[model samples]
Target: MRKLILFDLDGTLVDIFDEHINSFIRMEKEVFGVDIAPEDMIKNIGHPARVVIAGPLLERGIDPKVIEKRMETAYQSYKKQLGKALKRIGEDVVLPGVFRLLEVLSQRGEILGLITGNISTVGMLILERTGLVKYFKVHSFGDVAAKRSQMIERAVELAEEKYGFTIKKEDVFIVGDSIPDIRGGKEFGCKTIAVATGLTKGSDLEKEKPDFLFSSLENTEEVLKAFGDQI
Candidate 1:
């Protein structure tokens, strides 16, 4: 029997803050003819691009249907540009000690998966480009659900379906860098581990009451130590 570990992508495995911010700025300018500050966009972290874009547009009194269409067009264009940039940059480097921890977990035969707010296509591109794709046997993307808890539930379902066995909530671990991730895991009765590698700080994540919290992936030893007894 294998324990399932699901990870978030953007802030978990890749350092794409700059790329994401720039992309959003470009998209806003192209779509709305207004340049948005990167800071403004960063505040929308942990949310889907559509939601982020729609929120601002709605606040500005833009028609919902028009905003949705323009946002989608802008996002698609930005995606294409970001994809090219990623190809040029090659695989995003694995967080410190992440590769080592992954190797240890693989050797120990633990099942790994992905549960992220990114769409399937974008998540696949990020994982495949980052060389982390092989580590996950299953994945659930934002497109599957509008909420984080729903995504986690879907991932569990996929895991059971793919591996031919049911996984208890307690046997599933959710690792991510946002309050939503922690809250979703808690709601689903999965062990939650919050990492500070993303936009959220350790102090902020503490408020969510996750099972564990870490500064970054460099502390994989401590993370493994925390999970060792259970496995």
Candidate 2:
């Protein structure tokens, strides 16, 4: 069966952990004059950029209302800095087997969509740079959605509208490398595939009990099987 496979960009498809953390640190410290720790950022990975940013600020005793007020401005600066960061990092961030997996999946006629915590521009930049943008027909972004659940909803809505076909929830697969991704997929009534290629520990991902779990997507054939590919 052709599945509606929704992918999380940052950790699942690419290892942007370093650039992401550094950019967040610069945004919070330089723009907000507040030091944000890398660990705090890691704890909140896979969340919307706002939430990922807010967690550390909130922990630093910054008032929630204040953070909310500056978020629009802060995120704007963040996107710019992150763009520069990615440009510097180049396409090396694309993870192992990502191209081959996406290639085979696209060739197989399965629908692919991006459901990421990254804002549209930033997310598209990464995809464009890595040449993976062509494979995805649907784009669900973080700045547009307050939560992963909302992103998932947008992906489904856009997919159906773009392709003119109703997508069953069970046929939708949420692929990511964090707890929120798995939890949100389950809550949204979709199959979840957990990959430990992100900052999340494999044991923690196991606790969430995704429909399928893999250490990484390096084994193209094996990972394909999880997506129900006969090969």
Candidate 3:
């Protein structure tokens, strides 16, 4: 099997969840003069920042025209704030075993890709600065799709085009720390691995019943085994 592993950036391989939320708040306050409640963001991290905003705003009866007009402005503000935040935060957010795991997988000829709520531009910048970009062959960012599954579908298409080979959905492993990530993967019939290294608790992730659940990605050998270390 030609394994294609898709990693979620924010919570799975990096620790910028708080910075991400703070940046959104900063962007909203700067552009719209309204501070969105944190609860709205916290519950929807694995989604596009715009979708996250529009969903909550619509539910609360905000006008569609108002949202449409602000999306571009809001995204630009988000990009600016995120750039500032990442500089202050540094790459220390890269989690334990991430470097080694990626290194090993890359060496084994497994195709690596990123699927995250982050816009492609911001996502690439984060990967480049943190030294993880080289491992990935393709990516599908929040800009590509509002829903996580749709993002994965786009990423799969990109991966196939870039690599010139089709990957079986079952052989495509989706790794993340949130229920949304797991559910998103399940929608595509891909094996999901839940890592408790993010905002979600280990027990909580366990309840979601990912195909493989780990307390953290600190155990390199165990993680390698979960995805079939044919090497």
Candidate 4:
């Protein structure tokens, strides 16, 4: 089938775990001067960066405008740090079989889009660093929409606008490692494929009962089969 596969960038396709944690730590310590539990901090991730950084500050009674200004300053630091961060991610950061999977899908004429919680710039930077940029033609960024479901919806809408053709929900697939990915895909009426390549395990993803689930996308043939490959 010629499917439009919208992929979650961070944990599903590329491993940005280190950069994510470091950036959050810097933002909290330097910008907010607060220490956040890892779990608390991570829960903020996979959303818009501004929203993620502002949640804790807002809870501490920080003014919304002040939080905005602080985020602007913090974003500058994030951009600078990303230059160094890019050096650490490459083929290693790309999950196993990602390249092969992308290549095969492309050859089969399937559309590939990106749906990511990282802001547009950071998301593009990560893709460039991982050599995954060329695979995606469209994207719905976290900065543009705070919710993953919104991003998924945007991806479909943008694709339709770009191609001037309606996309069937059954022909759409959302692939990610997080619960939000599954929830967003399910809510948006796309088949969800949960890959346990991130913090979430296969056992956990199973409870979500996505249309398809895998420990990882290491097996390209099997991954293709999950999509009911007709090519």
Q: Number of the top candidate by TM-score? A: 2
Clashing pairs in 2: none
Estimate, for each residue in 30-99, the C-alpha lDDT of model 4 and write its tens digit: 7667776667677676666777778777777878888777777777666666657777768788988799
Candidate achieving higher lDDT, 1 or 2 = 2
Q: lDDT for model 1, on a 0 to 1 scale? A: 0.78
TM-score of each: 0.91, 0.96, 0.94, 0.91
lDDT of 4 at 102: 93
Instruction: Please give the RMSD to the true structure for each candidate, in Å.
Output: 2.1, 1.3, 1.6, 1.9
User: What residue runs in model 4 are displaced by over 4 Å at the alpha carbon?
Assistant: 59-65
Off by over 4 Å in 3: none
**Can you write out model 1's per-residue Cα lDDT over 118-212, one digit (the tens) per residue?**
66777788888888888989898866677788888998999899989989888889889988889888988899999998889899999998999
> How are the candidates ranked when ordered by lDDT, highest leading?
2, 3, 4, 1
Error of 3 at 6 (Å): 0.2
Which residue pairs of candidate 1 clash? none
Regions of candidate 1 where Cα sits further than 4 Å from its true position: 70-75, 229-231
